[model samples]
Target: MLLAQRLPQAGTRPSWPRRLRAWLPAVPALLFLVVFFVVPVVEILQGGLYNADGVLSTAQFARMTHTPVYAKVMLTTFWIAFLTAALSVVLGYPIAYLLARLTARARERWLLWIMLPFWTSYLVKTYAWMLLLSKTGVLTTIASHLGLIADTSTLAPSMMGVLIGMVHAMLPLAVMTMLPIMQGINTQLVQAAETLGADRATGFFTIFLPLSEPGAAAAGLLVFITSLGFFIVPALLGSPKESMIAQLVISSVLELFDLRFAGALSTVLLLCSILVFYVYDRVVGLSSLSGDAPRPKGGQGGRALPVLLAIGRAAGKLHFHRAGRVPGNRGLKLYTWAAVLLLVLPIAFVVPLAFTRSPFVAFPPDLFSLKWFGAFLSSAVWQAALWRSLAVGFSTAVLALALGFGATLALSRMSGRYSKPLFAMFIAPLIVPRIVIAVGLLYLFARLGLTGSDAGLVIGHTVLAIPYVVVTLSASFKRFDWRLDDAAKMLGASGFTRVRTVLLPLLASSLGAAFLFAFIVSFDDLTIAIFVSGGLNTTLPKQMWDDIQLAVTPTLAAVATSLVFLVAFVVWLSSYFKRHSY
Candidate 1:
C-alpha cells in the first residue's frame, strides 16, 4: 500500500511507451515529408534570400519588387484568379442549389454529369477549347457566319478565351465543394419558413444565403488558389501580353535559367497563398473545406429572420411556374441546365474531332479516318512519352498509397491534439499553389542531381498524389471497425497477422480506390512535370504542351480521346471492385 501510494496516479501522467507506440506509424510519412516537401520549400526560401556564391543577399528579388513587368504580371494573375472565382460561383450556385433540392435519383444523375468533366484530363479539356476556338473550328466558323466575330482568330488566343477555359476547368470543383453544405442544410427549416409566410426567392436570399457562407468561402478559396497556379490553360489560350504570374515563374527558370529569381517569385506566391488560407481559416475554419462543419444553433437570427420569413410568406402566394413537375423552384432549372451545357460543350465538341481526316483540327471533317490514332500509337516520340507517364503514374500510386496508409493508420489511433496538426501538415501540399511547389522542387532536385531522372519525377508525383490517398483512406478507415483487430489480438494473433487477416481484407476495396486515385492524379499532372521533367523523361502532358506550341495536331486529339477512355475505365473498375468488396 505504501509503494502504491508512492507511484504516480493512473490518469495523472500519460505513459510514454503507449504514446511512442501510437506515434511510431506516422514516423516514416513525417520523415518522407521532411525530406521531399519541407526541405525543398526551405531551400526555395533560402534561395530567395541568398546569392549564387552562398552569401546571404536579396539582390535576386529585384524583378519581383523593382521591375514594372513583374508587378504587372502579378496583378494580372490576381485579376484572373478573382474573376475566375467569382464566375465559378455565379455559374455553379444554381446547379448546386438544384442538386440540393432534387430527389435522390435526379441528384445522382446531375451529379454524374458534373463529375464527368472533372474525371477527364485538364490538358485534354484545354485542347478541346483550343479546337473549338481555332480559326477553322466549328464554333468559330459558326460565330463568323452569325456575325459574332470576323473569324476565330479574334478569339483563339485572347484573355476572354483564357477566362472561359479556366472557368470551365474550375466550375466543377466549386459546385462539388458547395453541394455538400447545401445538402446538409435542413430543408425542413426552409419549408417551415414557407409554411409560416415566405416565398422561394425571399427564403433563398435571407435564410439560405447567409448560412451557406462557409461553403461559398471554401469554394472561392479553392477556385482562386487553383487559378493562381494555372499554367497550361493560360499558356495555351492567352496571348503573351497577358501572361499570368505562373507563366512568368516558368519563364524565369526554363527560359532565363535564373533560379534565384524563380525562387523569389515562388516565395511571393507562396506567401500570398498562405496569407489567404490563414485568414480564411480564422474566419470560416478549414473544416468547411471538407464539408463537415457543425450547423449553427437556432434562435440566433433575432428579428431579422422572422422579418425575412414574413416577406417570403407574403411573396409565396405568387406562383412563378404552373407547369412545374420537379420538387424545387423551376426558375433555377433554366440557369442550372445552361451551366451544365456550358460545362459539357467542349467535351461534346472534341470527341468527334478525333476521327476527322481534314489534316487540321476541323470539326465535321471532309472525311473520317483512323490515321491520327494510328500515328499516335506508332510514333516513337508519342509512345515514349505515354510509357513514361504510365511508369511514373504507377510508381507514384504505389509510393503514395504506402505512405498515406501509414499516416492514416497512425491518425486513426491518435488523439485529437496530435492528429489535427499532423493532418494539416499532410494536406499542406494540396493547399499550397502547385507552381510554388514545382519551382521549389526544381531548385532542390537540380542541386541534388536528381533532375531529368525517373526517381525525381516519381518523388514529385508522389508528393502530389499523397493528399488524395490520405483523404480517401482516412474516410474509409473511420468507417471501419477496429474492434475486429482487437478481437484477433485477444485470440493471441500477432499484430501483422491481425492486420493481414482482418484489416487488409476489409480494406482491400478502399486500398484499390486510393491507388487508382493516386494514379489518375499523377497521370493528369502537368504543372509540376513541366518544371521538373526533362528531354529523356518527358510525360504526355508536357509532350502535348510542346506539340501545341509547335502546331495543333490530330494526333493530340486522338491521344486526348484515349486518355478519356483510360480514366473512365479506371473509374468503372474502381466502382466495380468497391461494390464487390462485400
Candidate 2:
C-alpha cells in the first residue's frame, strides 16, 4: 500500500474539482479583498499618474514635488516620525526590560497596564492630553502654582505638546513589541558572563543588548511607520507648523478641494511607506510585524552583533559595582515607573475631569456636575451617532470574523509556499497607513454610491479589522487539536458535525475575543469615518473629532469618559473569555 501510494497511478490525473473544492473557503475573502482593498488602492495609486480628463499624465506629480511648501511638509513629516520612533525606543526599552525580568504573574499584571491603554480609543486619549495641557488645564495650573511659569502658560496646540502626546501614544506599542524579543533572550548566557568575573552591567551589555537589537529595530519600525500617518494627536494638539502627511492629505481634500492633488500626495506617502516597509521586512522579516518572536538568521546585523558586544564589554570594564544591589538597577526601576506614569496620566484624568462643574476643562473640580453625561444621553446628535457606531461596529466585527475564520481554515491546509504570500496579503492592510486606506476607499466608494452610507462605513471598518481577526484566529487554529477531529471521525461523525461539536466549542473564546477586538477597532476608527461617513452615518469618533474642532466642550469629556468605560468593560470581558475559554 505504501509503495502504491508513492507511485503514480497509470492513466490518472489530479481531480481539478477536488482541488477547487479545497480552495473554495479562501475565495470569498480573496474576492472581497480584491474588490474593496485592492481596487481602491489601485485607483488611488494610478490616479496620481492621470489628469482630470482621465488621461495618463505626470503633471500633477511634478507640481506636487516641485512646490516648496509641500516639499517642506514632506521633510517635516520624516523628521517628526524619526524623532518619535527614536524617543519611543529610549523611553520604552526600560519598561520592556522590567517586564522581561519580572515573574510570570507579575509580567501578566504589568502587561494589562500597558495593553489596557493600548485598547482605549485614540481620540479619547488625545482629548485627555488636551484637557491636561490647555491654558487653564492641569499642567498649566500646576506650573503656575509652583512658580515654574506664569498662569497663562499653555502647551496645547504646540509642537511640544504634539511630541509629548505622540510619544505617549507610541510608547505602549514600543514596549509590547520589544517585550517578546527580550523574553526570548537566554538568561543562561548572561549568567555565564557573570560567572566569568563580569558584573551585571557587563553581562547585560555584552550578552543581552546585542541579542535584543532585532526587537528594538522592530519596535522602532512600528513606531516610525505609525507616527508618519498620525492624524488625531497632531490634529487636536498640534499647530499648522507641525502638520504631518496625514493631515496634509486630509486638508487637500476638505480644505483645498484638490482631489487630484490629494491623490498625488496620498500616492507619494503610500509609496514612501511601502518603500520603508519593504526595507524593514527585508532586514527584520514580516514575522515581527505580527508580534512574533523573531529568530534572525545570520546576516549583516548578525555580523555586526559581535562588534556591538565588544563595545558593551569595553563599557562594562569601566564600571565596577558591588554584588549587593547591582549599581543603577534601582534607578533603572524608578525610571521605568516614571515612564509608565507618563503613559497612563492622560488616560487617568479623563473621568475625573468629565465630572467637573466648571465650564472649562480644568482639573480638581470647583464643583461636581452630571450635565455633560446627561447631555450625551439626551442629545439627538450624540444618540444617533452612538447608535450608528454600535450598529456598524457590530456588523464589522461579525463580517471580519467570518471572513477571517474561513481564511484561517484554508491557510492551515495549504503548503508553506502558498501560505506565505496569502499571509502577507492578509497582513498588508495593517502595515499600510490608515490615511492611504481612507483615501482609496473614499474614491472607490464614491464611484459605487456607497459613500456616507452605513454599508460603506461597515465595509471600511471590516477591512481594517480583518487583519487583526486573522492574526487572532490563526493562533487559535494552530492550537486546535486535530486528534479530536480524528476521534470524532472514528466515531462516524461527519465533517460538519465535528466542526459543530468539537472545533467550534474549542475555539469559542478565540472567536469571541476576535469579535470584541474587531468591534473596538471599528468603533474607535476616526480616519476611515472621516472619509466614508458623515451626515446620517456619523460614528462616535467622527462626532468627537468635529466637536473638538468646533470647541472642547464638557460634553465631549463626558463622551470620552463613557467610551473609556464601555471599551474597558468589553476588553475585560474579552480577557475573561481568553483566560477560561481555552
Worst 10 residues of 1 by lDDT: 318-327
Give the per-residue lDDT of model 1 (tens digit) for 8-77.
2444667886678778777888898889898888888998998889999888677577888888888899
Candidate 2 lDDT tens digits, 1-582: 333334324326676654565567778888888888988888888888889898999988788678887888888888888999999998898888888888876777776667677878889899888888888777867877999876666787788788888888888989988887898888999889878888787777666887787788888987887788898888888888887878889998888878788888888877887888888877777766555656667534465677767876776667654642233657767887787777777788888778878887755765589988998999999999999999999999999988888788777767766776888888778777888889999899888999999999989998889888988888788778777776776677976797789988899999999999899999999999998996664889999988888888789889998998887788788777777766
lDDT of 2: 0.82
Compared with the true structure, all predictions reach lDDT values of 0.80, 0.82
The residue ranges of model 1 lying beyond 4 angstroms of the native Cα positions read 1-14, 102-106, 150-153, 200-202, 294-336, 482-495, 577-582
After TM-score superposition, the amount by which residue 565's alpha carbon in candidate 2 deviates from its true location, in angstroms, is: 0.8
Count backbone clashes in candidate 2. Answer: 0
* Regions more than 4 Å wrong, model 2: 1-23, 141-153, 195-198, 299-303, 318-333, 489-494
